[model samples]
Target: MTKFTLYLAMAISLIAGKVSAQDTTFELKVKLIANKIDAITKEEKEALKVEIEEVNKQLEAGTITKAQADEKKLQLAETRSKNIETRVGQAQEELKDLVKQKVDGKLKEDYRRKFSITFWDGGPKDDEGYKKYRDSINNNRSERRTTSQFVFAAGVNNLVTNKAVAGSDYRYWGSHFYEWGFTSNTRLMKNNNLLHLKCGMSVMYNNLRPTDNRYFVTNGSQTNLETAPMNLRDSRFRNVYVTAPVHLEFDFTKTQTNAEGKRLFRSHESVRFGIGGYAGFRVKSKQILKYSEDGHNVTVKEKGGFNTEDFIYGVSTYIGYGETSLYLKYDLNPLFKDNAVKQNNISLGIRFDLN
Candidate 1:
């Protein structure tokens, strides 16, 4: 038999043992009555527990005579027993009526559905084996990792190559890029609950604004950093890439679950860290110019090779408490090809992971 069925059988056997002196009919009735009483609500279950404790305290303190304590215990048992009997009687009456209809060949599909045997419909009631089983189920659920098919993160983006010219001082907020992506995590090292491998596609948008009113201009395959026609309010060199990121994540947070057995999102309360890298081809590149142009105003968007390498590769790491963390990434390849300055891309920002 399945584990659940075995537990049910054992529970019935134990209940039968309690009434060994009674006749077979009486024992059967007791088993049915036990099933009904087991359906009590959680609050009622707590109340029952409190009642027992109160009686024990009263007996030890001599607040009530032994006879009185005995009477109180008897009253509690009698009340619950009556409740069980009442429920069983109503159910048995319904069953008899249905049997009569079935015997008469008058049973319908609707009637069949209405005739299910539900001893405890509210929730699972406490029994020796059943309570343990429920706790085990909850514990197993908490150990299971939660997975999200899509994750998003954004923060400061920059170029790190050529540290002399690629310092944070040269990076401005307007020029700071943002990165966000969608990925799926698969549990790795089943024996090691903390380890997981995440792989997914992400889009990186890197914006570069020179300290001076300057932008990038392409001359053939080479890009020249030159001054703009006007003192620009905002100038950005944007690179778009479709990349695949892979990370090995190690989580130090305690996993938890709800009654439904779904993993709870607790990124905020736990420590999570990941190390990984990404490689992808650049899909597009452009330079945006926003400055006062004539009286009618002017906006320029230049799209071309921009001297940037078509393919990109990068290494990144993130650490944080909960879902939000400090993220750092550095490109392994130069930002531009056949250029005097061999600048590499670097970004620092906050990333929020949905796992």
Candidate 2:
């Protein structure tokens, strides 16, 4: 009976020892898992602290405002919470499965915490990330460059009156003349102050005709011969001129919102006014005449008196609307010798702007 009792006591003691060892092993695994979680949490806290510091630096540098910083911080906190919760939940589930299978569970939680910490810690920093982001935004907000323009024009001139030489008893005659030429204006300045410089060349052709009975003698007192009919001659003149002009203009316009729900700006659109001057030089001149001999038409070469003057001066003014400009010019130089030539040029023309 005593041997039977001793064997039973030994069996019970052996079972108690096994139970104690299993409990101790499970407690140790739980403690190791808790330690790993604590380490991960500490690492995540440090990473978050660094991230916040960078955000503060961006705020102080004016790269971002306080409101933007706060919004970013909220988003980051939400993401972090979701990530940590997912990682912790998955780790806990894996630990529970391992524990149910009676295997070591601590390493599962440790590995999960390690992955979460790595993901958060390897994220982009505030400064470099924001620079790239802002640059992308600004690149879409710039404007295009302005294009230049070229303009061209052409016209004609006709003469009206002709004067005779005094005391020469010569007949006075005039011709209807016409000139055709082109000018190109290049835009030099574009702003509230509209400035332009132009250069051009023109070719002119003229015709002259004399009247047969348009002569009168200056003196009749010393006539030793019989009175006779006066003989007259016909003449023509042709010339070419090249000119250059410079202009400075002003625009008084204001920007406003129209009633049609469109933005409108006043411009030199109607009645643009400008003041400028021009300088021109003569290029070529020629003369042709007709003579009557024995009641027959005959062509003759005459001394086409042309001056060798090389300079011309004038002032210009404009008054017009839209694309059509009406301009007037008055020559400051005499058209003939000794400044006694009652000849000054008056030009009236139209211009267009093409840009």
Candidate 3:
């Protein structure tokens, strides 16, 4: 079970068939302790060698100073030396028990069976037999229907006002949206992997940059984009949301018929399509403005509700083969509430599913 037990077994077995009247228990104890000390010294010294190599590599890579490396080496050497002393002490205690058992006729051939090489059993005695045994266990396993994927989607973000996207106030190139999270896909049918219900939680960041020197201003629960007094270098508004998304996915990956006549489905290998919607609550809303005031550069950060909707719902779709896909999503709720000109946030991006 433990290495020390194996060492004691070896010590006893070494002199078993050739024991002479001159071989006393004290001599046996001396031999056993000497072997254990040698083993412990070798083990600790090798470990110390590996640690010293790592420290040297770090120093060569400029990650540590010479003094730091020297200090680390000293610490590692001290640790290994202590380990040698402690392990040898433990081995001596084990040796004492073994010597007592030897005198009392308790130490027998069965004590050496833990090594596995000298003992014979009905199954898996050799390396080839053990490998086959392991393979049999692996081959009998079945695949699970539900699997998870890490989702990532990033693209341009913009606003559409009055059902018009061409003349929106936000600059399309300057605005962006990033979505990342994890999703789980479960086969809807027991026999087929054709249709799956995919659902997950995600975090999304949507940013908007006004075309002109404008920023959002809030007045009595009303938020509007208006021109700033000074010529602004940069002005952007961002909204972060935690959303739950659900999609019905069509996976056309070919199924494999194994020797057992089972259908093994490999998802995302061929063309696929997914249609879904998301609903979420906004985490936070903030605006940043940078401008020059009287020959001095200044930056301002404004955080508030800004009359923005706290609850958001959206429709999204993706189509592609394998792990990469074309993605698009549009908000059903307006960007600002109770405004004469209603604007909705929309985005198009590339999606990746790492399963």
lDDT top scorer:
3
The alpha-carbon lDDT assigned to residue 272 of candidate 2 equals 54
Which digits, one per residue and each the tens of the lDDT, describe model 3 over residues 235-262? 9899988899999999997666666776
Candidate 2 residues lying further than 4 Å off, grouped into runs, are 1-236, 250-270, 290-305, 339-342, 351-355
Q: Which ten residues in a row have the lowest lDDT in candidate 2?
A: 141-150
Query: Candidate 2, 23: how far from true, in Å?
Result: 99
* Cα lDDT, all candidates: 0.61, 0.43, 0.74
Tens digits of per-residue lDDT, candidate 1, 22-48, equal: 232222233343343335323455666
Q: What is the TM-score of each candidate against the true structure?
A: 0.55, 0.35, 0.60
lDDT of 2 by residue, 1-355 (tens): 2221222332233344422222323334444454454465566667777788888899999999999999887777666655654564455454444344332224343444344333234344355764555344323221111222222222222222233233222222243333223344433433222443444443332332334333212233221112224243544444445566555544333334434444333333444556787777765544455557799877655332244245777776665443334555556664443332254544444333322
Which scores better on TM-score, 1 or 3?
A: 3
Best by TM-score: 3
lDDT of 1 at 100: 35
* Candidates 1 and 2, the one with greater lDDT: 1
The residue ranges of model 3 lying beyond 4 angstroms of the native Cα positions read 1-142, 294-296
TM accuracy, model 1 = 0.55
